[model samples]
Target: MAKSTRGRVNAQGDGTSGLGMVVRFTPKARSEGVQQLEKGGFRVASSKDFRSAVAVPNDFDGADVQYFERFGIAIVRRDGERLKPMLQNAMQRKVISAARPERSYRALGGPQTMRLDLAQVGGVATSLDRDYLLGYRDAVNELVDRLLGKKGAEGLVARAAFDETSNTWGLQAIRAIEGDLSGAGIKVAVLDTGFDETHQDFVGRSVTKKLFATRSSEGDVHGHGTHCIGTACGPLRPTSGPRYGIAHEAEIYAGKVLGDDGFGTDRSVIAGMEWALDEGCHVISMSLGAATQFGDAPSDDYEQIGQVCLDAGTLVVAAAGNESSRPQQIAPVGSPANASTILGVGAVDRPFVPASFSCGGLNPGQEVDIAAPGVDIFSSLPDDKYDRWDGTSMATPHVAGVAALIAQSDPKFRGWALWARLIQLTKPLSSPARDVGKGLLQARGSGEV
Candidate 1:
């Protein structure tokens, strides 16, 4: 084995010397005390629930001593002897770094892209060490395993109702277009948390392309996007007939714009949008929103990219948001959703009743476009763990899928034509405030599409 030396790690802090392999440990084995040295000369700098931070002794000339704490244990100093096995064994202990402390943000992606502010406080360190960090890799594998199982299909179908055996809406939507029909032949892009690429629904499915705005390519660290994709166009498995997606056969390009923590930045999102456009996706579905607003319309960043998509014959769909209440707290519709051409979608429950949490119209006039069944909607999940989640994040895809269906049903319609067709097909809502603009999403005249 190559000789080991104590030195700096990667910018992300994997603990590798410039010329040596970085050491790592399994989560279960990270706590064993590797060495114990007296603490008389050190100053305890901080303390947290599990570990205590201490400044190394000024005279700490050797690398033989080990340090201990609840969060992690490590060898801080060693004698003049070369540390081959010592360094290799030290890798078994959770390797902590002065920079890039472990947090969910780092694993999902770096904080800069996610837009989270990290203020340094003298106290407990981050939970993730190299091994636990590597656990994300295992976590992703577990998700794939679950997605590959038979229950994966049943899990999504079960979301229609708590106990209902029938996936009525999902079934109806699939039947509307079951055969060989090229609808618009448009690319539908889904920018959400992540997706289980191993799911049978997506097996052999053409991923015209995919890009992770974050560091990892793991499937939905959270279920938001997975569920949305299922609603938009989860493939048809053998056992699960007809209860797949609104645009069951349409091609899907997934962009992981959000982190496992389900929070991401305007920059990362813009990057995702740009990638989707570059990939030639015809329609972009974003089941995400930002509370921060710009001027009367979307900011330049939102407008610029959205316009590019629109100009390129791509339609952008965004969630109206899930932050509405009395006196009407408007969260500005945000970014691409607020762009002139992009469609901002609101949410209504299964019974067609406007959901109280659904964000209201951007302005007093007819600003918000359509509403869809978002309340506790059932859809696919990561790791094959299925559950119903309620959010406009769930609502936006319904409309995107509808857009895809329209594109497939009427191939002649491109950019604006598809946009206009969807608006014209929707049924107006009884409550003006509840269903601000065009109202509930409906395409095929009184018949199911």
Candidate 2:
């Protein structure tokens, strides 16, 4: 057994209360690791593989279990004093690589204040309010200077800004090179609140639907899912308004992970993701996240699952979050999105300026991977509604839809290869890497994969 490389476990709450933690094991340590932990008296709750599980102690001092497969994370509760040493022992035995306390997650966007056409989801919301956009100007300038030295990089930066003069700015901002490639054969799954099956924009479109929320219906009571779906896979010539969707011909898979109340646990999220992968979705777009503070570690379960998805030719994209105070403070990328194997999308306006609410990243496992238009973006809502909303939530599906287009462009591109194509095709922005990442997403043109 190697010495545990992870730091000492800290008690999250009163030592007497049940606490949840996720233990991530190295690939090589999986089998031996679970065996050793079980032998040490830890109770195995549920697991997707021998590599991970929801473990618990026999009592306040022993282990118990509650397993979550979608996120590949575990939820355990017990006195920290009793739990730490056992986890430390597991680490020392080379059974686990890292461990962290579990917390709740939330949706990144909200209902339009003035909209009359849609219903809103409710929850005990946590606001990620801050102002930090102006402070990073110098860092962005310095990055632009460095980028200018590379061949073609300056041109890329110059082309990053989009024409915001029109109402369909998001479409133009992503540079959707819509030319024959309508994501024809690609399967895209959007895991969120649910879908508005009655939305006219999707009339006659083929869709695969699933409900993961306990006791919840598949129809989208909250409008978030419909709005996101509108951006990623809506009709090319919508009933009204300019063309808003990116992959008009894509096969839509709507998985309702969040309930009508706009809240969900990791269990539901993980279930949705598993369903998406099992259905062979080429791209999975998650516009929701649990808000996190700076330096928070990425989820080990999600990292492993993301890597597996990539290995199987699936690409997962999630919102970087809307917690930035812009120029003053920048929050870390949120869970699922924080996984290095998944693409984390930050928000920029039509002019290629970083959204004041968009999160930035410099942490090892929480870097932002790309940027997309998110502000004042128009898309479909429930009950044949249409409205413009804002959040990194809006930015995520743009990248997902474009990824679908890229995948449709060339059969050879999938998983990490498709991820690389996205970065390579981006028009570099003058913003710092922590803000806008590789730059704004760009779709391939006609006859170009």
Candidate 3:
């Protein structure tokens, strides 16, 4: 299975590499902004929820890109000298938040060692194979950069690392206050690869599954979703090993946004989010993200989506990303998770020490909300298997599971109230807020709400 990895950008000028730019219109100006762009001779491809549009500029110099009605954003293709001035003009007029030449996102995951036989799965053909998977990842990265940009997205790539463990330290980390709260009646959604319906661990569990990735099946061949679901809602008494899951009794909504190769575009992810929200899920756990540098802003689309979810009484939690090498290079929180309204989770060890791979909040909107046991954490996988992995991906589900427990503790606590309660009930660590926001997460006891 693929582990969470970072995405890289090639900023070199390559004029003919990609399609035209992507323009994100302001919330209030969405209706009129399209008209304004169209009148200016820009060829609009498609508009997503009136928030963003992909267009080809008719006359780059004569377009007057800065004269839009409201605050908007444009991500143009790398057209050498032609692109730089447009970016400068947009930035100077403040019409767009930021502008940069379009670049491709490359997955850091190394080469594939084996290929799976797709024949057995019927005529299903996905990019799970090594070469096709990389190409698919490239396209997804380009879409993400055009739509969300570097700072606005995370968990789009996966690293080539894995480890095994026998103990479930994540459950023990928050067990002090967990008590008997079993997350009953709460709807927890895990949006990643598909789930393994045939897995013995989840045979009798209540799971609502959906597939959004292209040409992808309804089962988890990538193992990312199954592992995350295991941490969030695995059984209390498993076939082997100690208890690893958090919300043992919570309802599971498994939405397959990422394909079996552990890669997906923003379209699939957004669709999965919409499905989860429509289902009235109390908590949505996204253990995926793209890499982001320090001092990068969050994506406007994701920010708006998160705020909408909050208003609708649902909490979205995402991984802060694993791009930091510590003491040398530290990355900021990744997109979707970087959104101010979204809860960003960082990884920690059983000893309460921040993981070396966990990212920190060096920028304004990239702060980590809380920490959870991610290093060598044991959880369920596909094929009735168990494995341990390390990444902010592993840590995110712990927080989600705890959020389920918290939401179940007090029905009145929803959205912002639930966010506030989780923050208030944490075990404060001595680390800086940039590293661990509030501190390590803790579940509510039987008597406490």
TM-score (C-alpha, index-matched) for candidate 3: 0.69
Instruction: Please give the distance, in angstroms, between residue 305's alpha carbon in candidate 3 and its true position after superposition.
Output: 1.1
Q: Model 1 off-target regions past 4 Å?
A: 1-164, 168-184, 236-244, 292-297, 326-332, 362-366, 445-448
Winning candidate number (TM-score): 2
Question: Weakest 10 consecutive residues, lDDT, candidate 2?
Answer: 49-58
lDDT of residue 223 for candidate 1 = 69
User: lDDT of all predictions, in order shown?
Assistant: 0.53, 0.73, 0.66
TM-score ranking from best to worst? 2, 3, 1
Once all C-alphas are superposed, what RMSD does model 3 give against the true structure? Answer: 13.7
**lDDT head-to-head 1 vs 3, winner:** 3
TM-score of 2: 0.76
* Residue pairs clashing, model 3: 152-335, 153-335, 154-289, 154-290, 155-289, 155-290, 156-289
Please give, for residues 184-265, the per-residue lDDT of candidate 3 as tens digits: 8999999988788678877788888877664567688888888889989888778888778878899999888777678765
Candidate 1 weakest ten by summed lDDT: 103-112
RMSD of 1: 21.0
**Which window of ten consecutive residues has the lowest lDDT sum in model 3?**
1-10
